[model samples]
Target: MSPSKVSTIAWDSFHNTVDGKPRGGKEKHRGVNPATGEELWEVPIANQQDVDDAVVSAQKAFESWSQVPMEKRKEQITKFKEHYLNYVDEMTDLLCEETGKPRQVAEMETKGVVGFIDFHLSLTLPEEREEDHEKVMLTRYTPLGVVGAICPWNFPIILSLGKVIPALLTGNTVIIKPSPYTPYTTLKVVELAQEIFAPGVVQAVGGDDKLGPMLTTHPNIQKISFTGSIATGKKVMAAAASTLKRVTLELGGNDASIVLPDVDIKKVAPELVMGAFQNSGQVCVATKRIYIHQDIYDEMLKEMVEFTKTIKTGAPGSNALLGPIQNKMQYEKVQTFFADSKAKGYKFAVGAPEVEQGKGYFIQPTIIDNPPNDSRIIQEEPFGPIVPTQPWTDEEEVIRRANNTNAGLGACVWGKDVERAERIGKRLQAGSVFVNSWEKPTPQAIFGGHKESGIGGEWGKEGIKAYCNAHVLHTYKQK
Candidate 1:
């Protein structure tokens, strides 16, 4: 297929919802098209009163919703999936307009919603009763009441659904609070569900960061599933502590990638570029740091640099491989990384060190050449279109260097020597380690953080159990 051209005409306005209905908030906020700095549409900003109403509705609905039985709940979720598919095209446009994601990337996130639902639908809730040793024992996993699904601006649709689907499939109601910058798609997506799910079974509220604390600390909320940066995640954890709510935080990742001396530079260079710059390197698992063996460091970095040149960086709707930063705050944050690199006089192997802000938040993809191990770019999560490359001679030392940071969400190793790659991968301190390729999280495998990356698993069987409170029953058997 030819590359998608930069394009967008117009779209209808969206709204926040409560009790499966579109509801207005106390204030109004305009959604900006990050690619053009244009105000796309206005959305209602949920206030304290709005959050209280949504949570109360969700809590009220949970009484019946949680008891609806897993199979019945799945039926409603299946219906929600159908609704999502029908409106996915529209969601894609809103996603791109609001987040400045390339057309293909936006579509991928929009469609990924179904994949999450299908996987959750296929999963079975644990309900078992066993009798052994003249005793009766039973085990069950049940919902933990209303869940607060707070989403980040990056990859809003899939990440939001990743939290919402499991919560609903496990028979828990949800109140979604999307990032203020990227509210249109998430709010509209939940609006689609209102028709399929019962009143208050699912709802979405829109607001700035203030709504996050409101939802997190609300007593009626039994759980908080947040996906964002580490500093904000710490605040979420602290807020949840007020009510002692079950918190699942998928925070920032300073993920690392290791390339051994034996790998094919031609074959792996493109993958390295994607690993580092996918979604303009804003992904939680997007490789923040790369360690290439000294034997092949120059050649590998050269190939990776050339591949990055082939990546088109511009507005969404074009054949551009990357779009602009989603919001001003994050754009400025990425700019600071560039500023620090320039101040310290670090070598930039790919694009320039800094960008001039104009109408859009565009930052051309860049690869920072082998900065010091303790450099700011190496130790921090930029969440932008810049990556740091390092050279290593000894495997053991490289492994130690890779695992030195507190942020360990994902890591990867690439080499033809399967045994050697797996050996080094095992020692890497991360929640998920990829052997020959960067791991794309599926519903089948569990993905999460190791140190400060996150608190709980997000996919697979464990993901299903996360929303539930495990219960055990003991009965005396006739002897």
Candidate 2:
């Protein structure tokens, strides 16, 4: 679709939903199409009052919803899943316009939500265990009432559902607060939930800045699940501490991929490029640094630069393999790294700084060669499509360098020698390690970050349990 066509499409004014009904606010903010830099729609800027109403709605619903049988909850989720699948096409277009990601990426995210829902359904809650004949202990996992979910702009649909599905299945009511940059698709997701679920079971509110703090600090909210930057994660954590609310944070990462001398340069170069530049490297787990064995560094660099030249970047819904950077603030952040690289005289193996004529957050995919490990591009999470590669000779030295970062979300090892790769991958200080692949997270596997990367995990049996509070009931016979 053309930019004008996308801009002129009838857009809905997203507002807060409390008790399954739409409520508007006096203040409002316009949604921008990042691809064209055009205003798409105006959504309500939720104030403290809006946050109060949303939490109250969730609190009221939790009392009754938490008591419903697990089977009935599964049925509701199944019905919602069917509805979501039927509306995938429409949702994909909305996602593309709001986030400026390719249609394929949007569809991939839409399809991934079903796996999370099904995983929650397949689980059986913990049961009572007989410690002995006379003494019995029952382990009960109870829901935390009135959960508040704050999702980031990138991958809004999946991340929002990532919190909503598990929290709802575990019998907690939720109020989702989506980032102002990309709130349309998430609001649509919550709108669909209203049709299948009872009032206040699942709700959403959109805002620029004030709404988040209100939701996080609200006394009525018992748990907070947040996915965003570490700086913001810290703020959320501090705010939730006042009420001692349960918090699960999935934050930033500066992931690395180690390439040993045994691998084929042509085979892994393409995969590395995709891992580094997917979503314009806006992903929290996208590979940020690459370490190649010094013996094969030249060969791998040549192959990677050649492969990167073949890929295209442009607006969404086009033949472009990669889209714009999603917003102006991020666009500026990526530029700082480029400027620093130029000032420090870093070697650019593939891309250089350039200016686009029109209004869009566009940046060419960049690859730097052999920058110092302490450079800003290597140390900080750019959250954009610029990656640096360095050469290392000794395995011990490389592993130490890889583990040097405070952000340890994901890492990868690429080589033909499985034993060596496994050994090296195990030593990396990351939450998830891949043998020959990168950024591959499944619903059944546990995913999270170590150190400053994140606070809690998601997308496994443990992920479902993150929303629950364990209550142990003990029985003792008269002695």
Candidate 3:
């Protein structure tokens, strides 16, 4: 695909939204196209005043938006969904340029956003009940006023909507702050919502490091939903504590995939590759570590390497299955792992120690063969295209190893026997456990982390409820 064909949206002034209109700031930050080492577009760098304006807008909007009928809110969301579907191609192009993900993956993220909207629409507000004569009880969910939502660059649209859609549906207004790395697509998405939602109902601001702290610590903001690194998540949590604001964090994950001895290597290898390398392995739930039963370890390793080689990596327009790393910071982070592996003389089943030098932040998809469990590659979440595989004999030992990490957003178990796979999968301490697949979360499943991975979750009925504050109403009889 040519560059012109991939992106048709005019690259013009990208501004922040306040109340329901686009507003520009004096200071600006340039968004780079990771696939080509070129500036994609310039977005405003929001300051304290901009943050204040956005939060105030959201708070004011919540006054009325929170009072709107549930059916009306759902109708607005349905309209937003229809509009998004119409421009899927343009959105996919913008997503690809900003994030360096393939067109297919970009499209998948857009589709995922639609699924989130549909799921929220399927839920009803908490109901009222009568326990006995002259006694009534009501369990109602109320919005948390102005919700501060911070989204990462990876899967920007879906992740942002994961907070935006639920919060709006539950009667809360939102002030969204998207990662500077990929702000255009998110801003555009919010811009679309402005048409359906009332001013302040949905708003977005783009800025540098300072923006996040401002959003979290804002006094008017009642709740926060953040998706990023564990370190930053801690900061967001601590800041929110100043006002004792409710927080929901989706953090890092060193997710593990455990392969039981009874599986077909051919069928499982491709799935494993997809699990580990999708979005160039920037996925939080991507399988970062793999543990194979020693009996089939050698055969599985061979099959995995052959299947991995078939995956191509290049710039955005190429027929590459994988695009460049999203940004320079991640590119350097992945390079450190390769450097350490080289120093320790770690053997690679596929990729080499050298980086793929070119116009983009491209790194070869690498698989390490049986690195020590103590190695950084094994213990840390690299969040790149490299993954490490180990061999295990005992089921209990492998389960322990998989659960050893502080991060546990997602885990997977593969085997021919369903009962056995479920048995092993249950032991892995992760939020979403996959039996035959990996890195795939349906709209209805609860997606979250266990330990350092995250606090709270998104998706399912519980996800929509996360944006709400539960209130109980009781009435006594005239007796």
Question: Tens digit of lDDT per residue, candidate 3, span 1-479?
Answer: 10122243344657889878788888888878888889877788999998898888887888898999988888888888887776777788888889888777677887777777888789876675757787788888887799999999988999888888888888999899999999998898887777667888889999999999999889999999999999999999999999999999999999999998889998999899889998899999999999999999999999999999999887667778898888888889899999999899999889998786788898889999999989999999999989999999988888999998999899999999999999988888999999999888777877889999899987787887888888888888787
lDDT of each: 0.87, 0.87, 0.87
Q: Tens digits of per-residue lDDT for model 2 on 111-184?
A: 77877778878975777676886888989999989899999998899889988888888999999999899989
Candidate 2 TM-score, true structure as reference: 0.96
Backbone atom clashes (below 3 Å) for every candidate = 4, 0, 0
Q: How far does residue 71 in candidate 3 sit from its true spot (Å)?
A: 0.7
Clashing residue pairs, candidate 1?
Answer: 5-317, 5-318, 6-317, 6-318
Q: Where does the lowest 10-residue lDDT sum fall in candidate 3?
A: 1-10
For candidate 1, write residues 1-479 as lDDT tens digits: 11122232124867888887788866888877878988877888889988888888998999999989788888888877876676668778778888988889888888877777888889998778999888888898989999999998888888888889889888899999988888888887787776678889889998876889999899999999999889989999998999999999888899899999999899999998899889988899999999999999999999999889998988876788899988888889999989999999999998886687688989999999989988999999999999999999988899999998999899999999999999989889898899888757677887789889999987788887889999998888776
Q: Which lDDT value does model 2 have at 35? A: 86
Residue 311, candidate 3: alpha-carbon lDDT: 93
For model 2, the superposed segments whose C-alpha errors exceed 4 Å read: 1-11, 128-130, 355-357
Model 3 lDDT vs. the true structure? 0.87
